[model samples]
Target chain A: MKTIFTRRFPASVKIIAIVVLSLLLVLSSDSLAPARQYLSTFFSPLQVIASAPLEALDNVSETVKSRETLMAENQKLRQLELSISDRLLKLEHLEQENSRLRAMLGSPVVTTQRKLIARIQSVDTDPFRLQVVLNKGIKDDVFIGQPVVDEHGVVGQVVEVNEFSSRVLLIADNSHAIPLRNQRNDVRLIGLGRGDVHQMELQYVTKNTDVKIGDMLVTSGLGDRFPEGYPVASVTGIENRGNEIYSTIRIRPIAQLDRIRYVLLLWPELATSDASAPEVLSQ
Target chain B: MRRSPFFTFLIIWLSILCAALLQILPLPPLVDEYFRPQWMLLTAMYWALALPNRFGIGSAWIAGLILDVLWGTTLGFNGVMFGLCAAFMVENNHKLRTYSVWHQSLILLGLVLVYQMLFGTLSSWLDDALVTNSYYASSFITLLAWPWIFFTLRKVRRRLFLS
Candidate 1:
């Protein structure tokens, strides 16, 4: 057999060529985003097929849930629903009064946002990134930057939308950051994910900031990606070093990132026009 | 003994598809994070070692491209790594085949380490983030898995084609 390294072009030359090619590809990755999105259209079906067995296993477990446990869960859910209905009655009265006050002040009436339920198709296994693929996509009117939440609080934002599947960048991803404020004191801060599923870090807050352990952090709506007043995380730890410029504040995300089975996709009031902006910018 | 070209091609493609499927199998998050083997790389190395002329750098590059798309990474990231690994395997195929399985496993451990390091560096550079140590765990897992993978592929190749 002929050897790969001939006298003319040795192994070193081939290796250099591969290195240069790789660097060029990396540098041009942004330009290749469109290609990647197009390719994802093809991958969507494969993803569905790959996750089929897991989905089947989940169904089997659901079917095997004991009747006694189901009855207990049902009782608990009914009691919770009754309490929530009571709160809803009070909220309805308060909302009507607030609308009347707004009309008296001649302000525009608030519009109700639309929401869609999306099932989690699969979770990305990359340790460095925390992302999940949702079953809803462009066909379901899911758009990039759409806020996703669960029963508890904010889950993440839709980053990539394909035809049948969309990728959500979780709040636990290292690259994710959300502008949030302390629910108690209204002290605004940026919560950044620490590349872990359980924790996020509060950045740019000074040691003297009025943040305390167990304080709830909610989206401040400053970035326009997530809606205002949605729970994001709760302060879990605060370390104030003597010589440090800022305090190290750690938070536990409210949404169970690992256990997410379904998410609600919020359709922003200005979604129609704003949805196209990300595609254009990405190109 | 000479094998039919079509049969050989079929086996190669089938093995690569199986590897890709294994790579994407849904496992528990913690186990997936720390223990997922580099299936495509191992299959590429197997092909390069067992049948260098038929499945060399070009085949490895193609397999890597498929893995890149599957893993949703930068297009050429895995492609370049797999190409380099296949190049090394092809260049040293004779010596690698002559060695015992124990020595082969040790050599593969080194190769897997280099592959992990290169991949970690490239991804970190692209994302402008620090490389996490968990990335190295995959290489260790792949090293432990190499002997089994090599033996299985060898058995398959021999069974499929009487060479």
Candidate 2:
């Protein structure tokens, strides 16, 4: 029943100490990257355990899937693959001719992307940040700032790397902004996340800017972080409120941000001396 | 019965882990961060009240640090707030333990308001942490959840052996 404040480890003093320590940790998170790796290594087991139910649900659905639907899907995929392969044959020819032309110009040889498949490990980021944990990490050569993309388009970039898992800040996070160009007219703009999973707003868009509904935006390669020419988002909605200097243009990410399962990690060709580097086929 | 402090240690760590799991459990977006009460803080508050000497500011600080990692908030961010919260609990442990659940809920609401406000503001300033109008939604649910958690945890505490 004694007054707790009078104790040696006084509440006020402890509060100040903790606050200072917490601020220090937050402000210098970059310096604490190694510390975060160790912390996540300890917590990865807990994260793995938490992800078990999700994986189980995935497995159950996979097993309980009706054979008829799967057959239908397989047939659809076969047709799509046939068409894709046909186009791929033409693409290979075009690629060779383009690379040959570039070689004739004495430009640097085209470098093929080294891709590794990774799975989304966790999707429970608080509303404050939009991020997902990838099961691949430092062990998998997931260096920070690596671009992640699904088959459709750009998803996000690696912000924090751990031992066995890394965190990717989604392109839809408010803090995230990507340089993009309109696919139709090649007009350039930056897409900024509005904290929504699918929607991003165009930055620095004047009312007279050449943008319209359904315009596809691709990576402009301005930042050089994300590779050029990847489809990012399409213009979903364009609005001009009265007297507003800038038009409000909403773009939805081409990648399915809501239900992420698997994605490909891109590396600069021969960027790493690891085993996976040499296996990349030149496109 | 004189119970070993190890029992207290076990209870705190076990509950902390459980809270961390629940806090990050992949529920739908709306139900996860908004609907979920401040589990880590609630656990810290309950134990700080039940065992004031054992579960004080230090315990809450550690719980918050873990949550900072788990919640994807700034490191030590939740730690600082939870530590302050634990200080409040330990300082007024006698009064809070004696207060009716209804009254305690009101007090808990005030504490949550502070936590949420500081979280929203600091997270925005510290980094471009997407603070929005919906940030206060979490505080609302945390307020509504206090009475049920207080009673359930009180019952659970009695069942556990503590010195």
Candidate 3:
């Protein structure tokens, strides 16, 4: 009876031993960084393969759209074009006048160069993080720190570069922060990412600051990583608690992350005249 | 009797694909950024609860590693969370086998809470991160999803393992 009990005891011990061994096996994968890198490289091709079907489906749907529907939309757009023409004429005059005024004030002419267009190929598979992968990569001269922007506003900066693709870390990522200044009053503040793709929080603003709910925040050019005068966000709400040293300012990001089709990767030219420009610029 | 291991593997791969799709789908404005549904977690939870003999802690850890790479998070955060959760479920398999739907749900909810706390604490310690209450909001959603996932998986198992 003692021998039989001892044998059964070893059987239970074996079960526990197996469970512990399996647990160690599970935990070991986390420590193997090389395995992850290898898996990403291995899985990237599969991602590209999977996304291709959706892209093709999108193309086919667009192609198969009825011409009658297109004609009506084109006619409506033509009417809109006629109405906006006068505004464009006035806008051109205003732009020239503004440049002239800036020249008179001896402000350096802000010229942007080195624009490379890239299509968004993928989005990060992590729900909590906001990141996008672009088709442009080192092959297209895209670098890790390149600034990606749309016509409307700044989008994000390239965080990782692959052979044929690069990943953009949006301003709403928890790790991203940008130096911003109010476009109206030029008061400087640090726009910290709230980890939400739609919102950023402004920090270090004194209670006496002139920031209002509708104030526009633009890149201050203090951070060399991002260019100056790019629209970052607009203040959506502000509260100056009577006793607090600083006001709490919340901003809504201007970029339409979902609507992005094409983005310009701004690769600064080292040979440019303003390449050595001072980091500090008044908002 | 032989288990259809190949079919099980294929289903896992399909689930991973679905999880990745769920991760990328844009949410509405009211959804908190930190509170997005953890598809990988749900899938891992399902596998561990249903098929401990096949999908064990080792499988969960591998899936978590993929998540870490895709998200660019601190490397092992999701991995450790996933592994621990799977092991917890596996150890309780015999007890879980006899549980009713409601009881299973409560267990899963507790497991989800534990997973979230593990990830949250690790995040705060590593990066001085501050997250809102939205992070835990997914637990309710996951509980609602658990029964559906369980039933669907059971159907799949019957179809695949049928002699």
**What does candidate 1's lDDT look like per residue over A1-283, in tens digits?**
2343333555566667766776777789878766767777876666787788999998999999999999999999999999998997897676567656766777634222577788888634344557788888788778888899998999999878778888888888888899998999999999998778799899989988999999999988787778777899999999988999999999999999989998888865532212221111110
TM-score of each model, in listed order:
0.86, 0.90, 0.70
**Which one wins by TM-score: 1 or 2?**
2
Name model 3 segments beyond 4 Å from true: A1-38, A45-61, A64-112, A121-125, A135-139, A163-165, A184-187, A196-198, A207-215, A235-238, A257-261, A271-283, B1-39, B49-54, B124-130, B154-163
List native contact recovery per candidate, as a fraction of 1. 0.30, 0.66, 0.13
Docking class for model 2 is: medium
Two-chain complex of model 2, DockQ on C-alpha atoms against the true structure: 0.62
Ranking by TM-score: 2, 1, 3
Candidate 1 lDDT at B57 equals: 74
Q: lDDT: which is higher, 1 or 2?
A: 2
Candidate number with the higher DockQ (2 or 3): 2
Write candidate 3's Cα lDDT for A163-225 as tens digits: 666778888878788989899989998988877777888888898889888989998877677
iRMS values for every prediction = 3.1, 2.4, 7.5
- Pick the winner on lDDT between candidates 2 and 3: 2
Where in model 2 is the C-alpha error above 4 Å?
A1-6, A103-112, A240-246, A270-283
Worst 10 residues of 2 chain A by lDDT: A269-278
- In model 1, state the lDDT of residue B4: 74
Lowest lDDT block of 10, candidate 2 chain B: B154-163
Per-residue lDDT of model 2, residues B7-89, tens digit only: 76887788778877776777876776578787777778878887777788888888888877765666788888888888898
Full ranking by lDDT: 2, 1, 3
